[model samples]
Every structure is written in C-alpha cells, then in structure tokens.
Target: MDSHNTLSARAVPMDTSNVQIPIITVWVVMTALAAVTVCLRFYTRHSVIHILGVEDWLILIAMVFSAGACVGSIRQTFFGLGRHIWTLSPEIMVQNGIEQFYNFLFHTMSLSFTKLSIIFLYLRIMSHGVQRIATYVLLSIVMACNVWVLIYQFIQCIPLKALWDPSVPGTCFPLAANIAAAVLHIVTDFIIFLFPIPTLLTLRIPKKQKIGLVLVFSLSFFVCLISIIRMVVLKNLDLTDVTYSLAASSYWSAVEINLAVICACLTTLKPLLARLFPKLLGTSMASGESSRPNPLPRKLQLEAPSSRGRPSRRECWRLVQVCVLPPRVR
Candidate 1:
C-alpha cells in the first residue's frame, strides 16, 4: 500500500510549455508549399504541355502520402508529442504510439514514390545505354530498401499490440536498423544528385542554358545536406527525453520531404513560367528558331540511327533538345 501511494505521487505531469506550436507551424507551412508546387506541376503537365507521363502520376501518389504524413504529425502534436514521456497520460501515450506507426508508414511511402518519380523522369529523358542501366539499378535498390523498411517498421514489435500498449509482451529491432536505413536514404540522394551532371555537361545547348540546368539539378544536393543533418540529429537522439529530442528531427523530416516534392515539381514548371513571363525565361514566341514547337512524339526516337548513316551534329542537338525541353503546343 505504501509503494502504490509512492508511485501515484510520482505521476505528476512534467512542464510541457511551447512544445506543440513549432510542430504545428512546420507541418502547416511545409504541407502548404508542397500542395501549391504539386498543383502547379499538374497544371503545367496537363494543361500546358499536354504530355502527362508516369513521373507525373508517381509524384501525385507521393503527394498523397506526404499529406498523410502531415496529418500524422498534426495528430502527434495533439497527443503531447513534445512533452516528456512521463508527462503524458495513458491515453495520450497510446495515441502517440499509434500516430508514430502511421507517421513512419506515410514517410516511407512518400519518400519511395518521390524517388521513383524522379527515376522515371530520368528514364524518360535519358537514352538507352549505361546511364539507363544505372538508373534501373538505382530504382531496384530504392524499391527494395523502402519496401523492407516499411515491413520492418510494422513487425519491429512482435505481438503488434505492444506497439501502442506497452503492457503487452513484445520485442523490437535494434535502433541501428533506423540508422542504417537513414544512411541508405542519404546515399541514394547523393547518387541521384550526381547522376545528371555528366549528361548535362555534354548537352549542345547554349552555355547559359547548360549552367541553368546544372544549377536546377544541383538543388538535390541541398536535399542531401538536409538528410545528413537529419542523420546527425538522429545520432544524438536521447531516448530518455524522446519527445524533446524528436522535435528537431521531426522538423527536419518535414522540411526534407516537402523540399523533395517542391524540387520535383520545379523541373516541370519551366514551360508554364515561360508562357506566363516570357521575358523572364528569355523566350519569345515570335522568334522562329528560339520558339520552335517541340518535335512530335512519333519523331522523337530515343536511340540514334543505325550505323548505316551517321547523324550530323545539328541532328544530335535536335534529339537532345527534344529530350530536355517541355513539349510545346504546335
């Protein structure tokens, strides 16, 4: 009876000041940015370019997952995510655990679809050769890693009920699995960031345009930097104060996922931007050479002609142009 009274006395709530606002702010802002960017991309592809492809569809799926993650984050905040675990009521603890499971699920799905969307974009633009083979290999790795992680997340605790209700018996995988997964995520981002550099360098476009393309793709490096920072933050995570430690990591995760979606959409916005602000994009609709319509899909073959006839430099330029530029309405 004395021990029971002592335990009851120790159950006092910890001070949980200012923990919820930052999470809510980050989720709202990042999700809004992702939504706006995705909507613009859809408009560009469907209404402006009129050539919606696999990448577009994949990105849309990613957006759905991202939205789910945002919802999970919001729900987590309401469940006292920023407070000390000891401060949370029993019901809040159960709710937070459930939210975390869905949070991981949504994040895994969002990232997988986002990477696949980018790979499909590359496959569509790159010619069949070593580059294409490398892309295929990367795709296989991404699919494998994400699927494995997703499966492991659910099964980490045997007697799955223990995930939300710790009163039940269960065991979980080591934390090292999470670190390893994070490393793979960062490495893949690095590879994707570097993949397009060589091809962009060899393009026959104007030097300015080449530089612009390179800079645009280099934005992925920032995403990689964010990933590295997240890993570092995770390394320092304090399990004793999980809610506090998780605040920084959660903010970074939100920023990383939303930024990835934004970058994916940015590449597709050139045509719409050129149309809306021609001078800003250095495009003039009246200039015959500068504003030529995109080559017809049927005429834009991915492979070079057979050895029978070697194509001239001008012919090669046209092929590259067709691959890189958004299709214009004739």
Candidate 2:
C-alpha cells in the first residue's frame, strides 16, 4: 500500500471509533419473516404434535431475525448527520468502509452459522445411513470454523483500536484467519445444500413428491450463493477507498442477512405456505376428498359467508366441525 503519504496515512490517533447500515429494507424483510413463522403455527400436522414438529423452523427464524436486530442497533449508533456522514472526505471514507465491512462480516457470518444448523436439521430428517453420518461430520466442522471466524471478526485487532484507527498501537494477523474461515464456511454451505439431494432423490415417495422435496431443498442453494457473493465483496471491500461508507456496506450486508432470513423461512414453507395460501399447503381441518395425505391438508372448507370474500369466524368453526367428523350417513 501507500504507507507514508499524508493522504493515505491514518489521521485519528487511538480514537478507534464506535461502529454503524441499510436499516429499513432489512427490518421489513425481518418482520415478514416473523409474521410467517407465527401464521404457520396454526397449520399444524397432528395439531398438538405439529406445534412441536416445526420447532426447528421457529429456531432458525429467530436466529436470523435476531441477527438483523443486531445490525439494526448499529444504525442507532452510527446516525447523527455527522455520524452517518462521518469524515466524508475521500481518505476517511476508505477507513469507514473497512469498519462497516467487519461489522457486516460479523453479522452475516453469525447468520450463516445459524442457518447451517437449521439445514443440518433438515439433513437429519432426510438422510439415512452414510449421508446422515457425513452431514453430522460436515456440520461439526462448519460450527468450529464459524466460531473461529466470528471471534477473529471483532477481536482480531490488538488493543482493538487498530480496528478503525491505524494510528493505534497494536498488531494482528486477521487476513489468514478471516480468509480461512470464510473459505470453509462457504464450502460447508454448498456441501450441506448438495448432500441432501442424492438422498432425497432416492426416497420411495412418488415422483411429484420427490420433485417437490428437491425444489424446496434447493432454495438453500440461493442462501449458499449469497454467502459466496458476500465473501467476494468482503475480500475486495477490505481494499475499497470508502470501505466504511454505510451505503456500500449496508446494502450488501442487508442482502446477506435478508437472504439468510429468507432461506430459513423457505425451508419452513410447508407451514407458512399453508397459512398464506391454504389451497397449496392444505388445511388441518378441511372437509373432503382432495387431501394430499401429506399430514396437514388445507382447511379451505367454507363455513360462514363473506362480504368482501374472506372468511368469518362462523365459517372457520363450521370448517373445523366438518374435519372433526365427516357428514356421512350410510
């Protein structure tokens, strides 16, 4: 780099600053993620057991939404007009960009780690002999490396002041640690996503069901892609002139966390889709022959009337009664 030049030199001495990102888009998606989780609960399997059944879904959803909340606090810390535009000068923007990068880094890596746990949960459900064992081994490695990366993320700088202000007296070797952790984390994401497919492909279920499982699980691939992309952005981001600029860091960081939330919600689609579009996910207490036999069939039987075309409480009660006992007299 440009070591001794004034323009390129560190200006702030030992004042390594407090940190800061896109607050709104991230919140909106996170809210939707929470709403879906709540709605899905009513779409139970064995009703009581169904609530217990989707526990993993609930945990994954919480992990992602909570991570967004962490980044959300940064906005509070980083936002006086002076704070947001802190040192708008070009050289200082470079430093700001680096700081944001690490903030985003910690947040997204935490998210990736949590989502992998959920994905492994799915792997356990779907895998058999060898695949199941392999998945467990892979996930162990993922958790270990991710923990290492997270520690390195915020703690790598000595005296910690070297994080935002190079003028601070300290030392660190974050490059190797960061790069190794990222590489392993990315690899684990892809592997978790892939390992399930072959096992899913071999299930004794019908063709349509098999295809549905494949498609649904493949959504995790999108999450994997986002992590990989973030990895690249972060690597180059460390070099950018405006590395701490909120816009640059916030935009992609939001993408990364939002994507994690989206993936968590997707895996749980069996429940959420049932809530939003009951016709597709099938109802718990519906009356009739069109049941998919896949546990929670849609509860779309009309009971009461609607003025604007939605159901009334009476309608819901009648539908429940019908499922409770078929109206057959033989």
Candidate 3:
C-alpha cells in the first residue's frame, strides 16, 4: 500500500502539467503583497508612531530573507522545477538542487526571524510576570530550534557538494530528518499562535477593542494552516519524480513564508489602519490622544507607587493606558 501510494502520487495529473507559471505567479504576487505591507509597517513605525522597536528591525531582516526565498523559487522554475526529474538534463537537475538548497536556507531564516519578531512584540506588551517569562522561554526554544536547523542544513550531507552533485562519494541523512524539522516548525507555529491569548484576555480594554486586537494577532492562524498543508504535501512527496512531485510543496512553502511575513507586518500596521479607518480600529484622528500613536516609554513601565502606599491616579491611568491601548495607540 505504501509503494502504491508513492507511485500514484508521481502519476497524478498535476505532475505531468507544467506548473512553472502558476508557481511563479504565486511567489511574485505574495512577494509583492509582503513587500507593500512591510513598507507600510515601517512607515507606521517611523512616521506615525515615531518609534521603532527591535521587532521592527527583526521583521525587516525576515523580509529580506523572504525576498531571497522568492528569488530562489523563481530561479528554480527556470531550472525545470515543475517538470519530471527524468526529463531534466543532469546539469539542470544540479542547478535546481542548488537553488533548492538556498531556498531552504532562506525560508528557514525568514520563518525564524518572523517568529522572533512576534515574540518580541509580545515582550513589549507584557508586563514583567509569569507571562513575560513564558514568552522568553518560547523565544529561547525557537532560537535553539532554528540554530539546529541551520547547522543541519549545511552539514546534513557529507562533503557539502554531495547535496547537489549526486556523483560525489558522500552520504546524506535520510528524508526523515527533513520530516522531523517540518513537524517541529508546525509545533512552534501552534505555540506562537496560542502564546498571547491569555495576556490579551486579561487586558482591561473595552470588549470591542479587545476583540479587534485578538483578531489582529489571530491572523497568523491562517499561516499556521498553510504550514500544516505544506507539511502534508511534503510528507507524501515521491522522490522518483521529485521535480514534479515537489512542485506543490514548493508552492505552498512560498505561500507559507510570505503569508507569515504579511501577517507579522499587519499586526504593526494598526497605526496606519487606524489613521485611515478610524471608526474600525477605534481611533479618532480628531482627538489628540488617539492621533499620537506612540508606545509608553521604558521609564513609564518601571514607575513605582507613590509614598501613599499605592500608585497615584495619574500613574494608574498611565498603566491602564499601557494595558488597554495598543502599542501604536499608547
């Protein structure tokens, strides 16, 4: 049954079709969308908020890697990515493999940095408490996993050139290693998706604003779903007709990475969106308080109670503002 399944996958109608156009279309469109969102995010951070956090810089790095991945995918199409392996010349096959190697590196870097950017955003919002500690733990795990993957990416095959040049006399790890990495990625996606919910729920914001914030962060759930779908495609991949069978996996992989970038940028775009659609995001441009969308300063977050044994009304209000308002709104 296993052999039959693999054989059937290779024989599917899509495998015989030239998917180069569709693949290129998906990558190009997604890259453009991600690029625009990233630009707007920077505009909001610099012009509207007048503050740029570490998360912003990290996301910019992620976008750079995402662009690299997009370039790799487009290049692969020209090297026979959407055709059967048997039909490709050995030279073309080697070229495609080289592109694939770089694509894997770029995609992995994009995902790691994108995740780190979101986690840092969480850190900025969360007060020093158990929740903050949890965020740190998640950050550490993500960093460790990504570092492991990066190391494996370069050394999985002995004599590095063996990865693309099959004629090289060196061994490579079995396909199971790649599968394990994919599964780990999906697991982290789930964790990151759920990490902020408890903090959001405990916020003292208005129900409407709370819901809007939740919806904004939850947008990454769609990226999680795309990751799972891409993992499924990879799990059943048939190596005999690798070039053809891998097309769907590559398409979905590009979608997953680019869509993640789009979602990450969207979270920081609340200021821009609020300026345009004041009624929707609960910001009124007419009001000075809502017009200046800057984050509370570090000193404000560390302020202490007055000599009266409790925080003053002014300090309490500032705390409330910190918690109830979005970073871009504070």
Candidate 4:
C-alpha cells in the first residue's frame, strides 16, 4: 500500500525539474526592461525638466532615485539570483535569504521612484486647479502604502535566519502576513491607475486623443491586474511542498518584476511619445470631432477664430454653410 501511494503520488519533482532556467529567463527579460526604462527616463529628463520649471527639482530627485533603484536591481539580478535562488546547499541559504531581502527592497524602491516621477510629469502636464492637488494627495498615499508594505516585509520575521531556516530556534508569523501584503499591493496598483482617468477625460483634446491617453493609463492598470493575479498565486504557496512552493514563487516573482518594468517603461515614455507622434495623435483626434457637416468657413476654423468677446467667425460661417449650402453639395 505504501509503494502504491508513492507511485500514485508521483508527479513533477520541483527541485530536479528544469524550472530554474526559465525563471532565469524572466530575470534577463526584466534586466533588458530596466535598461529601456532608464533610457526613457533620460529621454524625458531634458525637455520635461525644463518644461516643468519650478517643479523640475522634483523630477530630478525622482530620476536619481529611480536610476539608483533600477541600476541596483539590474545588477542584483545579473549577479545575485544565480547564487541566491539556484543553490542547493543549506549553508548558502542564509546568505541567499539576505540577498533576497535586498533584491525585493531595491526592486520595490525602483518601482516607487519611477512611479512618482511619472505622476509628477503628468501633474506638470495637466498643471491647473483641482487635478494638480489631487495628484499630490494620491501620490502621498501610494508612497506611504508602499513604504509600509516594505516595512512589513522586512520585519515579518525576527532573527532573520528564520526567514530561510524556519526549523531553527526562531519563531515567525504564519503565511497570512505575506498574503495580506500581496493583496495590499494589488489594491495600491489599481489606485495608481484610477487616479488619472477622470481628469484626463476632462482635457480639451479630441475624444480620440483622450482615449489614447486613457489607454496608456489603462495599460498601467492592466499591469496592476497582473500584479493582483500574481499576489493570488503567492497566497496559494504552501511550505508543505517546499520544492513546489519555491518553484511557484519563482515564476510569480518574475511576473511581478516584468510587470514592474512594463509599468515603469510606459509611464516614463508618455510625454516623449506625445511629442514625437503628435501628428498621428492629432489626426486621430480630429477624426472624432464631427462627421456631421459644420456651418462655417472650414479653412478659417482650421486656422483661427475668437478668443472670447468676438463671435467665433468660424461658428457663424459654419451656421451659414449649414443653412445655405445645398444638401447635395454639403
């Protein structure tokens, strides 16, 4: 009966199975993503820094912070993971545990720095009235929440070795703490996304342009969704199957890293893309204006009109054209 059970229970062995290589692949992709993320940061640094004026200092500070974090994370992934996540020796597990802590710390910091910079840039872009105030408020909350999450992770276990070697004399919290943190992370991610949507819709740009901007943010939100799913996977991990738990976490960790890079890349690229591809966006915007004929001088409306007191000659002309122009001709 015991032999029968062992045979019946046979499945993939997480430790010996070739899972680490694919996990390492995720790391390589994440590193490349970080490289591009930094390049994008620099791309905006010149124009965004100047355009931002007095608020420019904030951009610089965010840039330095993100750069440090991204660069540090990339280095750690390149040199750190092989020794930390892949080794089989018990003696190495403790040091690997320390590396894992730093790895998570810097990655989270990098993500936070990059996100704050993106938020500041958007605030500058939409600088006026209520939205600006809201931007700062939302940012403060996101930053605070992220910092708290990091604190919880670091302090989740005392006498640190318990983190890697739970069989040692130290005691630690059950898995519930980690699960809760992952849930909070998913919540924070959605908040970052929803913060900009309504204000962006209020802009004077074309509806299609508004949609494009919204879609950019929506991509960020999508990242948040992926994060939430990753969190759920994290919550399912059980130490009862140490091999399988480690394997499952290894994959989810990569997903989280790549998603971080994606969010970082998109946010930093916003202003530059808008500037570079303005004409494409302008065309998309104009198409949404009105398929119905307008009653004005088309050429003049395309050029100039009234500021305030003056009747919009363009509107008057459009009215006349609508009234006078033959239906067939129109």
Candidate 5:
C-alpha cells in the first residue's frame, strides 16, 4: 500500500510549481529602467534645456501609468498568478483577476499617453504641410481609440464586480473583444512607427542629422515587435491554467510599455547627450537643440570671397554663424 501511494503521488503534478519569480523579476527590472529614462528626460528638458513642452509632461504621465502597471503585475503574483489555477482558492483567483483587470487598464493608458507624447513631439518639428495634416489626423484617431478602449474596458462586464467574481449574475464580452483590441493596438503601433519617416525624408537637413533621427525613431519599432509577441503569446494562452499560462504574456506586456516609455524619452535626450559628450552627436547638435522648425535662408551669400569685397571675412563669418548653422540641431 505504501509503495502504491508513493507511486501515485509521483505521478501527480507538483502543486508548488509556479512562474512567480520570473514574472516579478521582469516587471521590477523594466520598471527600474523606465524610471531612470524618465528622470533623465526630465533633467534634460527642465534642467539642461529649460524648456518643458507638452510632450514632456505627457511622457511623465505615461511613466506613472507604466509604474502602476508594474506594481499591479507584481501584486498579481502574490494573488496566485503564475500558478496552476486549480491549486488556488476561489478568493485568490478572484483577487488575481481583479489585479489582471487593472493591470490591463494601466497598460492601455500608458501606451496611449506615450503615443500622444510622440505625436506632440512630431508636431513641434513639422511645418505646415501634408505631414502636419496627417499627424493631426493620427492624433485624432489615437485620442478616439483611447477613449473607446478605456470605456469598453471598464464596461466589458455589466456590474463591474462580476468580472472577478464570476458567481455574480452579469454578462461579459467574449474573448473576441480582447482579440479586436489587440489587433487595433498592433495596427496603431505600426502606424506610429512609420509616421515620421516621410516627414524626416522631406526635411532639408544634413545627411548626418537625418541618419541620427532615423536611428532614434527606429527604436520604437522594438515596442511594436514586443506588442506583436505579446499578442502571439496570448493567442495560445490556456485559460484552464490562466495563472500559469498568462505569465509569458504579462512579461512581454511589461517590456512593451516600459520600452515605449524609454523610446519616448530617448528622442528628447539628444541635448543632454550633446552636453555630456560634446562631439558625440556632431556639430549639428553643438547648440544642444534637436529639432529645427526653421530652415537656413537660401539667399545667404557663401560664394563671394573676402578679396572680391562682396563681404568682408568677418561679416561673412557672422552671416554663416547666424544663417547657415542650425538654430536647432534638426
């Protein structure tokens, strides 16, 4: 009998198996990195440049939402996330569900704000043209999508408490709703990732500055990739063991939002880098400004020599300094 019982126990899965450590570690590290980036961004804008635009403030708000999502993710682990659903008590399951709900809410708000920050940054540098009009249209779409998503997320279940407390008599949207949201999210990510390329190409800036801008904007594509990965992970998730199955999705979500935060801040950090590392960004950034709203005047004379008496050497030098040099680094 003893041997038979031991064999039966061995055949059963271990109740202690959980992915808590990995999930918590991912959130903690991503949140820390995001915090550092945001602090650096604020220092660059407020202390170094002494100009804080709406974009800066929007990014700060996004950081707060991202931090909240991180906290919610960690809290879920304590409430039976990353464990077998069968092993958790109903109360713990309900608590975990509640955390999951809020975590999703936080994630949505964070991305929305980060994208808004990026849109505003684009507007600041763009001139009055098709690029600006397209940006305005994108801005309207983002705002409308955010409002709809926020409302839908809150009301997905009638009698909100029923979302976590399944015993309550209420209805909730099907998984199809989640799939729709994820699809829209991915589409917007792609749009945002590609929006600035055409404008960047049209700008009559130096080749070097154009390259640098391309590289900085390219960083956001990573966030888009993370969002795609999370969608894939969630697509195959097993609701029967949701707590354990959702771990990978949660990890990618944390990474996606924090990375968005980092990218948004990084675009504004050129001045700080130029200050610290002088030649790192080249002469275009010598003045520590990154965007150029005004182009150099075309009528400025650069062909006439001092000997020709069109303009003295000193006078030409002054004109070049004021006209040719980038007021903002482009």
Candidate 6:
C-alpha cells in the first residue's frame, strides 16, 4: 500500500491539449518576416542598385541561419516544448534534448552572422578614419567572442553524447556559463547600437535627412531591448521546469534574431523606396543616379569673376570645401 502511494505521488497528470501553439505561432511569424525582408534586400541590392557588396552577402548568410533557428524552434514545439517536462514521454524528451543542442547552435550562428552583417555594412558606408578603425576593432572582438561561444557550446558536455543522453556519465558546463554568455551578448549589442551615433551626427546632410537616418539607425535599440529581455529570461531559467522556462527564452531569441535581420535590411531599402515612392522618401534620385555628379557643385562653380564682382577668399575657400566633400545621399 505504501509502494502504491509512492508511485501515485510520482505520477504527473497529462495535458493532452496543445500547449505549443504560441511557440509555433511566433516561429511562423518570425520566419515570414525574415523571408520578406531578405527578398526585398536582394532585390534592392542586385536588381535595383546593380551593386551587390560584402554586407549584402553577410546578411544573406545570416538569414539562412535565422531560418535554421526558426526551424529548430518549430521542431522543439513538437517535442513537448511549452508543456510541463513531467508530461513528456521518454522518446519526446530525448528528441527534445537533441533538438535543444542544435537549437543553440542555430541561434549562436544566426546572431554571429547578423553582427557581422552590421559590421560589414558600417565598414562599407563609413568614411575611412577613426570610425572605420573602431568598426574593424569591434568586428574582431565580435568574431572572436562568437567563435568562442560556438566552440564552447558544442563541447560543453563531455563525451558529446552526454548532451542528449542523460544516462551517459559525463560532466557538463555549469548553467552560469550560459548566463555569462547572455550577458556578453547584451553588452555587445548595446555597443553595436551606439557605435554609429557620433559619426551620424557629423554628416553634412540636411537636418530632416539626419533625423530620419538617426531614427532608422536607432532601430537597433529595439534589438538591444530584446537582448536584455532574453538575458532576464536566462537568469530565471529553471532546470527542473525547463520546458516551461525555456519558452520565454525561445520566443525572445526568435524575435531578436529575425528583428536583427530586418533592421540590417532596412537601411539598404532606401534606394528601392526612392525609386518606387520618391515622394514618400522625399528624394527623386533613382538608384542609377548615385554615380552622377550633384548639381549643388555646379551651382558653386565660380570661375574667377570680374575684379569688382569676385567673391571674398574665405567664401571661395568655403565653396571649394563644399565641392571637395562627397555628395550626400538623398
């Protein structure tokens, strides 16, 4: 009778209804956004601009990894994710373990590539000086940190198989390692979000254009917010209630990565928008007109005027400086 009581006490009631619906929904929405943004970026870079550069390629690769991460999340949902761990069958649990390992890999790769994409975009657009040097330094740091995290992720559990098979006798890294990683990610995201601000403010563009660019670049602040939320979720991660606790992290990770991809693509869409809806973007310059000389320089074209009408030397120097500076993007 005592034994029967013990067995009954250990048993958990099953929840037959689907608890993973929300996870699936989030994944579906994220994947769709990533797809749409990637398509638009490709069209703008290759067909519209006729200049496909390194940043475009990096973003494309990041999108691929983002898709992989989305697929992993969807697979996790089918294996008792979003439900109580006690309700999972042994087979589902095993599958979940395997899927979780791959999910981390997908997440790390996606995030690394996204950062690289942003860095490459900065390198391409920024003038060669302290800003460019700073970008290169950040790129190196991001690459090293991401690679270390990826390597650590795969080797965190000894015997390798111990990652998926709890029966194996092997050591695993402490959960603190994961928390530390989350903190690092959030820190780097904050840095990346703020890195371009000083240079952006120094541009010679009109005030309206400057404000618009600032707002556009400031979209990374949302990504930083998402990273902070992910870090909070990681801090409260419950090993015993992993399936439930991990749902928050999974959702935030999906949103963060896909949103990063979307943000990276947003800046590249200006040319396309300028072509399709010039009035909306407040620019009539077609994508192909990027190479043409600006009419502003011609207006400043002042050959040596008659002695009486000649401008002051200071005014002539100012005009020369304006002519030497690169044309602003409309």
Cα lDDT tens digits for candidate 1, 269-323: 7767766765556532233466543332333223355565644333433333323
- Stronger candidate by lDDT (3 vs 6): 3
Count clashes in each candidate, considering only residues at least 3 apart in sequence or on different chains: 0, 12, 0, 5, 0, 0
Q: What is the TM-score of each candidate against the true structure?
A: 0.83, 0.63, 0.83, 0.67, 0.84, 0.82
lDDT of 6 at 292: 39
- What is the C-alpha lDDT profile of model 3 across 1-330, one tens digit per residue? 999999998887453457888888888899889889999989877776556779889999999999999889999999989887877899999998999999999999999999999888887777747877998999999999889888999998998899988988999998888888888888899899999888778866556666877897898999889988988888889988888887898889888988898888877776566566655554322333454433332332323555645544333332332333334223
Candidate 5: tens digits of C-alpha lDDT, residues 236-327: 88988998999999999989999999998887776667557654543442345554333333333334444534643333333232222432
> Where in model 3 is the C-alpha error above 4 Å?
1-17, 283-330
Q: Each candidate: what lDDT?
A: 0.76, 0.51, 0.79, 0.54, 0.80, 0.75
Q: How much is the lDDT of residue 291 in candidate 5?
A: 42
Off-target runs (Cα >4 Å) in candidate 5 are 1-7, 13-15, 284-330
lDDT of 4 by residue, 205-304 (tens): 4565467667767877766766767667667755444433544455555555555555545544544554465444223213445444223122222223
In model 3, the clashing pairs are none
Off by over 4 Å in 1: 1-14, 283-330
Q: Top model by lDDT, which number? A: 5
Tens-digit lDDT track of model 6 for 70-122? 88888898887788887788788888889988988888888888889888877
Error of 2 at 243 (Å): 4.8
Question: Candidate 3, 304: how far from true, in Å?
Answer: 9.3
lDDT of 2: 0.51
